[model samples]
Target: MDFSFSDEQRMVQDSMRAFARAELLPKYTHWDRNDEFPREQWLKMGALGVLGLRVPVDQGGQEADCVTAGLVIEEIARGDFNCCYGILNSCFAGDILGKFASPAVKDTWLPAMASGETVLCVCLTEPHCGSDAAAIRTQAVRRGDSYVLNGEKSGVTLLMVGDAAIVFAKTDPAAGAKGVSAFLVPLDRPGITRHPYSDMGARGIVRGSLFLEDVEVPAGNLIGPENGGFSRVMQTFDYTRALIGLMCLGAAQATVEETVDYLKQRQAFGRPLSTNQGVSFPLAEWSAKMEMARWFCYRTLWLRDQGLPHTRESAMCKMQVPVIAADAVHDCLILHGHYGYTKDFPVEQRLRDVIGQEIADGTPHIMKIIVARDLFGRDFV
Candidate 1:
């Protein structure tokens, strides 16, 4: 099997890497330092088509393949890990809307979203549920031409600055997972209120909780069909899980490069820190692990592009990559000595930023359960 990227893919990868280094790396720390959102950078990314990788070409997007999208996010993450969130959310929103939303909904939001003029967030996790998404208590009741929604969705990334949310709620509470339905609800809706969180990492992404108190949206905003939201979201998660792996890997890879540079220039006992096996060995190990994880992620994305079953592979990516990335960044931090602990260097912030991903998407525990279920049969697991 051919493992090489096509010429077009390589060109896109190089261009994104250059963009990340020149534009995003310089100001990566500014947003986290001031607890500010990277709105301008996000807009720039939109202008660069980074936010539109999953959108259709007719909708002003590249409509790139899944593997290509993965490549773009990985390169972007190297420069600014937090900015990668915009691409991640956009890809998720683009795919969901492109395939399911009504013509009006698609025409209005997709182009604007591709242009970076608007942001959309997925609201699935609730104050009471996360991996147990089916247990979400958010309710959306039909009201003639609209659905009146009421529920609390916690851990919504980009919520504070988002224009709207793809809110998943139960239309028929008795049906459990089957009862869940997805809606594209504008954040400005009368009963919608937002509360931003003061997260330790990825603060620039501004994750928060969305509270819908009798909020209303036109019935046409329904994504897919009623009672079909759960499976749709699960399928989406399979795609994003692979992206998450690449995203975290980019951060870890960047940290490794930075550590290598520092170690070579810094001296210990009249020699560079890189001369020591102790210092170099950890970096070596991490590099190898991250390389393996990166290929696994790309293959998972490849499987997706081929329309093959990769739910188990995606779960493995989610379960293993972030932990590997976090550990690699942590070691990179330690390798930098006491300086790594300070905010003066990007390593500390990278550590903080990378750690949050360990919890985001799906926690390792939840991911492991998915893998286990697949391997041992659903009944045994």
Candidate 2:
């Protein structure tokens, strides 16, 4: 596989980096503090074609390959972590709808989604079932030309602002995994309710809970076949989880930056902090991990472009990147000492945000399990 990025790719990366610095970083902390979603930035992302990077051009997308998507997202994440979460769902939503939604549904939604006029979130995690999505209890009952969706979805990102969601529910409770189905439901429906779920990090990501009380969507809103949606959701994950890995690399890059800034001025034993091997070793280890993790992400993306099976690579990158970032955040905190614990400093916020990522796409333990399953043929315990 060609690991080198083309000139066009480099230009895209550089342009996104510049845009992120100018547009995202300056306002990032303010949004975090105020718990605000920057709709303006999301629009800017749409104008730049950043929101539809990995989506198909036939569906009003830029037709970006997976690596290009990773490049765009990594730059945004490096400058503002929440930008990663927002851009991620922005693009992934359109991708899912384009791939699975019916022609009429796509024709209705894809144009608005591509233009950033509409926002979207995925509703897979029920209050009871999270990563184990097959355990979803949300049920959809057929009611002559409509499906009545009834249940509550939790840990929902972008719900407060999203216009549509790919809601997961059981079409037949007895069928287990085969029973899971997805519906493209609008947030404005009368029976649907969205409320904020306050949390420790990624404040602008706007976490919320979605409640469905006999919410009705047209039969045409069904995405893929009834009782066969788990495959679609996992297919979406196969494309997206790598992007989350790159997001972790961005947070690690920021933590390394804080380390560099503090080391020049911080004193220990009448010398600079960098002079101490105790402080420097962890940072050095983190540096190695980040560098390798970056390349691993790119390679996995390239594999995705080649239509290769990259599930194991995505799981490995997802598992390792956050662990490395967490370690770097741990040291960067001690480097700041008391200042780190205070809200006045950004490191404290960075710490919480990176830790929150461990559970964002898939848990670290789950990633390891995925890798093992991929390697050992599902027979080995």
Candidate 3:
């Protein structure tokens, strides 16, 4: 019944909100225009302890709960949507490595990643397969003391600047999903080539493809069991699906607030535009939708904190919230008229940024399948 955040949660939220407005918002467009990575801001986020919320305290991270991590990402997205990608990558890498990686691997990467001295990316999607993740063609074969990996991973976020990658490859192709394994491969290793994309939005993060040819790593780099990586990554996605919802909602909410101010001062037909229900009702409607979606996402993250069944809830958030956020931003752009189309206002950028998320974690079609399978049971579905 209690819906309010705790004192500690409030403190974290207030600090991140202020940091977003002061440090991140001012330079948000600068990085996009220049096609540069926000390394300085990434370090600042590390110093603030936001980058390691899911990493263990013993491993140089805050090791905060899932709900607190959700708050941090949402607030940051309000200032810079692309920067939220860093938080997402860190949390995924932190949780997966802290729990399952060997001491040597964890010792080398976890602390540096938490300190923002290095970055890690998850390599699951391939050029040939995205939604059907199990059908990936990446292959890893065991040698006497090392595993040789050869595959092309596409649609990776932050790959251009990633120091290492949690690469997933098929160790037993006949076993389907159970045959997959994960490895911590340093990007500087030989036989690795990277190619960056010219994305329409969020160009600051620099999504790219990782081509691995005969890349070798020690056996100790294997995460979890020999064939347990598929389930481990899917579990991590459940946590991130809710986070994605909040991230998009943050950007949309900021646009809503900005449009409200613009509407009130804008004169139309010798009267303020805010006076007309036609001009104001869409904003009001989208506001209510986003508010409802925001609370749902929070509840989903809370369920994760409590270790409850939330796969269905997480899929629902992924399925609906981003679409709602994208629609709201598109409508807000229309409201801004000619100015919204131009880079003069952030609305246009927000629209392009928000749309990428609609396809990132899981498309609506795939998410629908997850929810349907849950509702009717696997056999029935």
Q: What residue runs in model 3 are displaced by over 4 Å at the alpha carbon? A: none
lDDT of 2: 0.83
- Per-residue alpha-carbon lDDT of candidate 2 for residues 1-381, written as tens digits (9 for 90 to 100): 456899999999999989988998778678888988878888887788887775568777887888888888888877788877766775676667777789888877776776777888888898877878789899999999999999999998888888989899999999988999989998999999888978888888788999999999999999988987888778768657778878867766876886788887888789997887877787887788788888988888888899998889888888887777777777788877788888776777777878887888789888889999987888893
Reference-based TM-score of each model: 0.99, 0.95, 0.99
The C-alpha lDDT values of all candidates are 0.93, 0.83, 0.93
**Can you tell me which runs of candidate 1 are displaced by over 4 Å?**
none
Q: Relative to the unseen true structure, what is the Cα RMSD of model 3?
A: 0.8
Could you tally the backbone clashes for each prediction? 0, 0, 0
lDDT of 1 by residue, 173-214 (tens): 999998999999989989989999999999899999988899
Candidate 2 Cα outliers beyond 4 Å, as residue runs: 267-271
Query: Which digits, one per residue and each the tens of the lDDT, describe model 3 over residues 1-381?
Result: 989999999999999999999999999888888999999999998889878889989889998988899899999999999989988998999999999999999999998998887988989999999999999889999998999999999988999999999999999999999999999999999999999999999898899999999999999999999888999999999989999999999999889888999999989899988899987999999999999999999999999999998899999999999999999999988888898899899999899899999999889999999999988989987
Error of 3 at 88 (Å): 0.6
lDDT of 2 at 350: 78
lDDT measured at residue 12 in model 3 versus the true structure, 0 to 100: 94
